[model samples]
Target: MKIQYFIPAMIYSLAFALQASANHPGSNLDDVMSEKETFFQAINEPDAPSFELINAQGELKKLADYEDKIVVLNFIFSNCAGVCPLHSARIADIQEKINSTPMKRLVQFISITTDPGNDVGSTLEEYGQTHGLDPINWEFLTKKADDPEDFTRKLAMEYGVKFQPEEAGQQMHGVVTFIIDRGSRFAAKFHGLKFKPINLILYVNGLSHQEKKQKQSFLVRWWEVIYYYFIH
Candidate 1:
C-alpha cells in the first residue's frame, strides 16, 4: 500500500550500465553497490524502515526533514484503550530520559496513526498533552482513512508496519519502534514494552557519529558544492 521513492530494479540496472560506460572501471559498480547497500541495510536492519508518515501542524511530513537528526518512529492509533497507552507511557519514559540528556537536538520522535480517519489534528494534540509529550520533540501524525487509503498506508507499508481495525478503532500487532539513523536508514528497532531508554540513547549517539563522518566524506563535500551551485 506504500509508494516507494526508489527506482525499480530494471531502471537501476539500466542506469548502472549507462553510468558504468561513462565512468571508470568498477566506479559505477561501486556507486551502485553503495546505493544498493544503503537500501538493503535500511530494510534488512532488524526492525528498521526507510520512511514514515507524519502530520506536523496539520500537514503531511516525509523523512527528509529529519535527515540530520536521530529519529524514533512508531505506530499508534489514539482511540485504542488497550496496549497503546502502555506503549505511549514507555515512549514517554524514553523521551524524558532523552530530554534530560545532551542528545536532545540530535534526536526526534514520531508516532504515526494506524487509524488516521478518526485521529485528526485536534485528537493528536489532546493525546500529546495527555501524555506530556512536547510538541517540538514528539509528533503525532494522521491522514485521511478512506477505502482507497492515503498517506498512512503508504508510509506504513514502506516501513512494514501492520495494523488492523477493531471494534472501537484499531489494534496493532506490531509493537516495534523503528530507529532511523542520519541517512534515513533504519539503524535499530525496539519493542514498545521492553525497549530500554539507555540503549536507545547509545544507539542514537553512535548513529549521530556515523552520520557526521559520512557528511565529512570527500564525496559528500563535492556533492554539496555541486548541489548548492545548481540549486542556488
Candidate 2:
C-alpha cells in the first residue's frame, strides 16, 4: 500500500461503512446535523488539500499527521484585528466543549496562519493562548522555513477560501470551520461566527462514533459471511 493510495482506500472503506450503516439507521447523523444546525453545510468532497506547514516548534506538519483524528480546521492570520479574533474565539469555545468530554481524544483542532511571515515563533503560540485554545488537542500552524510567503494562503484557497492580503496588514476572508473525518474525508463546514458551539460539538461527536460504528458493522458482515459459508 503506497502512501498515495492509502487515503483513497480509506475513503472507499468509509463510504462503504456509511452506506452500510444507512440501511439500519433511524436517521443519518450528517442529515440530522444539517437539519439542526442552520449553518452546518455537509460536504462529500475527496481528501482535503495537502499541506506541509510548521508548528511553533518548527516541526513539519501535514494533513496526514492527524488522519486518525477528526480534524476541526480553519485559517486565520495572527495580526487580523477583525473577524479573525472572533472566529478563533469561537473555535476555542468549541474546543473547550469537546475537550470536557471523551471526544477530546478523538478530535484534532488545527489553525493555519494565512500570514506565516508575521505569525512565526511566539506569535503562533501566543495566538492560541490568547484565544483560550487548548494545546492538548489544538495546534496553530504556519509556513515552513523555505516555503513561499503566500504558501499557506494558497493552501487556504485550495480549501475553497481566500485570504487576500491588504496594505494595512489584514486579509479579507470569510469565516468557515471545516470538519474532516478520520481518513481525511472532507466532511462538512460550520460557517461563520453565528453557529452554535454545541452543534459543532455534537457533529464532531457524531463523526467520532461513526468510525466505531463502521468498524463494528464491518466485523458483523464478515462474521455473517463466515457463518454462511463455513457453518450454515
What's the alpha carbon RMSD for model 2?
12.2
lDDT of 1 by residue, 142-203 (tens): 76333344556566766766676556555645676777766465664565565435444433
lDDT of 2: 0.76
The number of residue pairs in model 2 that clash at the backbone is 0
List ranges where model 2 is wrong by over 4 Å. 1-27, 211-232
Global CA lDDT of candidate 1, please? Answer: 0.57
**Clash pairs for candidate 2:** none
lDDT of 2 by residue, 1-232 (tens): 7743553343334334442211112236667667667899988666878888889999989999998888999999989988999998889978876676656677899999999879998999988889999999999999988889999889998888898888889888988999998778888888888887756765665565433555545534543453344334
Question: Evaluated with TM-score, which candidate comes out highest?
Answer: 2
Which residue ranges in model 1 land beyond 4 Å of their true spot?
1-56, 144-147, 150-154, 210-232
